[model samples]
Target: MKYAVFTGATGGLGTLCVKELSRLANWMVFAGGTKEAELEKLGKLPNIIPVRLDVTKQESVNATLEIIKSYTNKLDAIVNFAGMTSFTSLIEGESVEAIEKLLNVNVVGTARVNRTFFDMLYQGHGRIINCSSESGWMTPQPFAGPYVLSKYAVDAYNDSLRRELIYLGIPVIKIQPGSYETNITQQVYENFDKTISNTKYYKKLLTKMKPLMMMELNQKNDSRRLVKTVIHAMESRHPKLKYRVGTGKLLAMLELLPEGGVDVVYKLIFGKQGHL
Candidate 1:
């Protein structure tokens, strides 16, 4: 049986990924999270085993590995879907602390898991699929400073790992999808409130962005489509280095433009005062 370890199985996209992977009879999947009760519930399924994994802590990862030993010695894949995003405005003195928190989870935590599982992946000639976002490359927007920084780091991290893993016959793949229907969007307004509070400039900026945020929440791409693409990356004989799904092209085009061009586009969309 092919065994895979999937982290962040509790998030919106991760939940969908977990559900789909559970349906595959040939695949034995370890759904990773810190919630023991939820993980135990998922473990009730035929091929799914839930493991209490905290990627940020070495001890937790080591403990989880020991559990895996009881099941299988080889791992066919490690899917990192665990991540978080927060809104911030650097100009408003939004602390780098938020960025650090996200990096701890999205970048450092991911590296930790991959490093801990390297032997298993190498022994099985497995793959690593990281869930990134179009924010990795697109021009920075008004309130997503911290999130953009973390995603850019993710893009670079994936690239470096992919190069190193090539000779080892392990594929490091990145899936960059545009806005998808997820809980993240639903929390944007709340994030904005937390980040923009106590700052006059950002409060004004929020007035302008409220409508845009609402519209974006309604415009989320079909998450099932992204899930399908992800499954294809897992099953394909030769997967692409990166998979772009949904509004990826639109965001990619934004990246192609100069900074000034991007600003102009934003102005056109959000108005001269940055209000729709």
Candidate 2:
């Protein structure tokens, strides 16, 4: 039987992928999350073993490794969906602690889990799939500084890990998904609200940006589309190094411009007064 570990399995997209993966013949999935209730519910599903894991803590990751090791000596795949985000202007919103927490979960947490599980993956000659975001490659948005920074780090981390592991026959793949209908939007909204409430100098600017942020959030694509790409990355014999799903053409076009040209476009969008 094939064995796999899925972090953030309680999340919207992660839950979908875990359920779909459970339907595969002879496949066993260790669905890792910190939520006890959700993990218990997921455990009831066929071929799904729910594991309580907090990627931010090394002890939790080690415990999860022990739990999975008890069931199997090798792991065919490790899909990292465990991540967090913070939406705030770097200069005026969100505390340093909040930014550090975001980086810990989204970047360090991913590295922690992957490094912890590498031995089992090596034993099975498995693949590692990391869920980055379109923001990882796209130009930075106004209020999403912390999140964008974390994803950019993920992009770099994955590239470095992939290069180092390729010679060992371990494929490290990256999934850079566009906005998907997920709880991340809700979290972003909450963070945005906090930013607005706490800002001293950017209140007007944030107010102007609110409508645009709402519009972008509301336009998220169905997350199942992204899940399909995750499945492809998992099951394919030869998956591409990167799978980009539902990314925006405008973002792509903006990226094609010169750095100064991109800055000019942003200036026009938000106006000289910082009103969108």
Candidate 3:
């Protein structure tokens, strides 16, 4: 039986991907956050086994992997959509510790997943999808420093691993979602506020910066786009190296702009983000 695995099965895009992949695979086993309730609900699906997983912790990841490894010797696929975001501006914003957490989950955690399952994917010639960001493209967001940096790492890691795994010929596809209808916008704003209250760097400037928070919260994209993208990536006769989904071609054009120009343009567009 072909089995698939996924991370971040409790939330927005993760939930959508879970449903879509579940339909395609004969059986699906996935990992979730600290919440046991989420795991319980998700496991109720027709052929799903939701395991408690904390991607940032190596030991926790190992323990979860052991259960999965013992269950299935042949794994077909894995999708990484587990991520967190904050609206801290680099020059004048939140704590360094927050940024550290982002790197741990967004960058290191990703590498860990691919590395941990290297043996499985190789032996089975499986596929892996890394949920990258458009911000990692030529469009460098002003207040989204941590997110951009981590995504950039994912992109590069995919490239390096793809080359090394070529003898195995397992496909590695990167999915870049522009924006989708998710409660993440509200969540990020909440994080921004909490981070700002205790932060001293740019408290005054950020206090007045509520517009950027609302703009991100209001940005819209179709959730179905991700479902379609994932399905295509899995079933396509010749899956491309990367696929980007979103409502905006603006960021596409931004990808063509030089680094200097993109930076200048963002400064003109958004005077100040979550940073002072």
In model 3, where do residues sit more than 4 Å from their true spots?
92-94, 194-213, 247-253, 267-276
In the order shown, what is each candidate's alpha-carbon RMSD?
A: 2.7, 2.0, 3.2
Give the alpha carbon lDDT tens digit for every residue of 174-218 in model 3: 887776657666677777777578666656546655665465456
Full-model lDDT for every candidate: 0.81, 0.88, 0.73
Give a tens-digit lDDT track for model 1, residues 1-276. Answer: 889888887667877888888888888888898766677778777788888888888999898888888988889898888888877777656557877788899899889989998898888888999888888867877778888888889999999999998888899999987886677766666777776576655565577777766665567578898889888888788999999777644456778889999899877766654433
For model 2, residues 1-276, the per-residue Cα lDDT tens digits are: 999999999987788899988888778999999888889889889999999999999999999999998999999999999988778777764457777998999999999999999999999999999999999999887778888899999999999999999899999999998776688778889988998899876777678878877876677577778878998999899899999988866677788998889989878776665433
By how many angstroms RMSD does model 3 differ from the true structure?
A: 3.2
Instruction: Write the number of the candidate with greater TM-score, choosing between 1 and 3.
Output: 1
Report the number of the highest-lDDT candidate. 2
Between candidates 1 and 3, the one scoring higher on lDDT is 1
Model 1: lowest-lDDT 10 consecutive positions: 267-276
Off by over 4 Å in 1: 91-94, 248-253, 267-276
Residue pair clashes in candidate 1: none
Model 3 worst lDDT window (10 residues): 267-276
Q: What does the lDDT read for residue 188 in candidate 2?
A: 88
Arranged by TM-score, best first: 2, 1, 3
Give the number of the best model, judged by TM-score: 2
